[model samples]
Target chain A: MSRAALLVLADGRFPAGGHAHSGGAEAAVKAGRVSGAGSLEEFCRGRLHTAGLVAASLAAGAVLGLDPVELDGAADARTPSPALRTAARRLGRQLMRAARATWPSAELDALAREFPKGAHQPVVLGLAARAAGLGAEDAAYCAVYESVSGPASATVRLLSLDPFDATGVLARLAPDLDRVAHQAVEAARCALVNGVDALPAASAPLLEISAEVHAAWPVRLFAS
Target chain B: MHLDHNHTHDGPPAVSADAHRPDGRRRALRIGLGGPVGSGKTATVAALCKALRDELSLAVVTNDIYTREDAEFLLREAVLPPERITAVETGACPHTAIRDDISANLEAVEDLEDEIGPLDLILVESGGDNLTATFSKGLVDAQIFVIDVAGGDDIPRKGGPGVTTADLLVVNKTDLAPHVGSDLGRMAADAKAQRAELPVVFQSLRAEGGVKDVAEWVRGQLAAWVA
Candidate 1:
């Protein structure tokens, strides 16, 4: 697999409609759970371990040739908030459009036909990676990185925190990202041997609860 | 290696720029309106809807920076049925939603077509932003950049992308020019200099038939699109 494919897939500016979402960071910021770099790091770390792990495992499973339809069901089962589910499907649909234009895989086209509304976003991301000649590990890395990167950048906007400090927070969390990606890949391998049930189902209850509240806000910066 | 394969598919087109829908009928003519804050964009949209609704089937998609204020205003005014208007959250960057990353706007327009479709026109109004904001060509066939005399008479001279590159440059709030001490003649001349052959419309929606000229421009665009 080309190493550069991972960079293209992971770039925040890939134009897959991820910019409109804060990945639950907007809620954390508003709830006073995240303030500066220190608190932001804590929030990202928690997200990386729970929602990040689950999303990464799902993505890795998809790249491992696991059925995306079932993986999408697994994703829905892991994500407790109805609002987050809607956001995931919306992001999935948008990502499908971008992926079909960029990579143009028959598999991606089939998935698009299957889920006209959307599949889960991580599932689409993994299929996009496969279409781009990337591996399961690359897909997992993409998911885990996005999990932390989203909230870090969002905090820069939400708190007016120094951009450099946000970068520092991400840089400091590199080891954790690597560990989570490794764990996710191992889980995906296990799932291939057993079934989709072997994937992690880590849950972040506050993130789920806050996402529900954020979706109803009449006025807010981020979508979720 | 797989990238060399043909993209022929059996489902709806992935790209939003396709003029035809899944069933092979031409889609609506999409027009985007972008301008600075308080530049009468929503008012112009309301007026245009009021002017054209009886004759054409139209829907609106608003990219509001934070609130659904623009959509609510259109609904409150009863410009069209509540179902005819949709608002897209811009995450504080209106330009990104319309220009750099248009996935959200594309989905909104496609949804409009799927639900209230075979429509003649779809008006996409950008959130009030700076002079640099403009709609992506993929998102809209034609774009109108709005500026008010109250903003500055010299905006045309300043000449950003929106002022210089839009299909139509509208100088709104012409009635306020006198009170605001803005020179319409100079604004017009500067606009002529910046836009060579592109069209410009100056109007105050408070006046009788204020949106008529702009509405006619839209009608011409629709005629060309359908042709």
Candidate 2:
């Protein structure tokens, strides 16, 4: 894929309203689960391994032209929190709008029309990757990057960390990004070869709990 | 370009997404307006732009968790030029981007300034967050907390930080007070009691050209900035 394409997909500036979310980090922070950079890193790493892994795998499946309805169901099942689920669909819809505009494709438009509300981010990202002509690995990379980067970036702003130091943390996670991408592609390949309808199941129960608690706070920095 | 045997790319060089970024010094004052869901935040933003756009070069960034509904609303109203307005679909949790991780919001503001050239103000409208939703100081220079009389007359008495500490507290929808059974006097008293010396404005966006009073306040802030 062209570098411009990759930039558009990963640029935090994209019109996909990712700014309004903490990716569960806010909830984790309020619950005393994630305090500092190290704890934040650990929390994000866990998400990358669990939810991030699932998102990557599903995105890979999408790149391989799997059914979006099936993918949507699978994603819904993995996300137990109604708040988180609602969030994912909202993000997915926004991503679809930008993705459709930048990289027009019939499949994406059809998916957007079919599931107007409640489409998960991974499903739409996968379709976008396919439309952008990115390979499964790149698709997986973008998915994981989007998932983790938002929270990691949010933590920096929330905590008022040095911007340079924050970038260093992101740089350190580069290796993990590669690892998760490879794992996603492998999972996608396995699903294809084995004819399994199920995608990889990896979810964090604690994140869901935190999200719910965060939702009820009288004063909070992040939405959820 | 020949694909490398290994997974690493050997084709064209990967474009650094953050490369050659514009000078950070000359950016506009990114202001985030956040409050409860449907607290007239969108209405406030639209009114502000309509009132202030001619005086100052402006752009807007709106965060709508699932839809571009707010952005679309502004576009439909023609509050600002289409190119000057951008929406960030936050996916979920409107407070996160405004307060927790502001990269996306920051980037959006910067991108607008980059495309539109130097802007005096960039208003970022957050998706309706709860009473607690506040913008991270890192993302915005000033913040506004909005509440409508229709949500509840006692909302001011609740006295969350957003109601108390935001640069300004806007008591919107006063015109609806009679219809909604909200006590305008009690709300104003509660807000003044809780806010102490902080300023508050009660206006009916539907009636008073919606944004005139708040627009004047914004002008005062901008004047102070220049001073």
- Best-fitting candidate, scored by lDDT: 1
lDDT of 1 by residue, B112-223 (tens): 9888857899999999999999898899999999999999899999999999999999999999999999999999999999999999999999998999999999999999
Each prediction's TM-score versus the true structure: 0.97, 0.55
- In model 1, the Cα lDDT at residue A79 comes to 89
Worst 10 residues of 1 chain A by lDDT: A109-118
Best by DockQ: 1
- State residue B148's C-alpha deviation in candidate 2, in Å: 20
Question: Which residues of candidate 1, in runs, are more than 4 Å off?
Answer: B1-10
What local distance difference test score does each model get? 0.93, 0.78
Q: What are the runs in model 2 whose C-alpha is more than 4 Å off?
A: B1-227
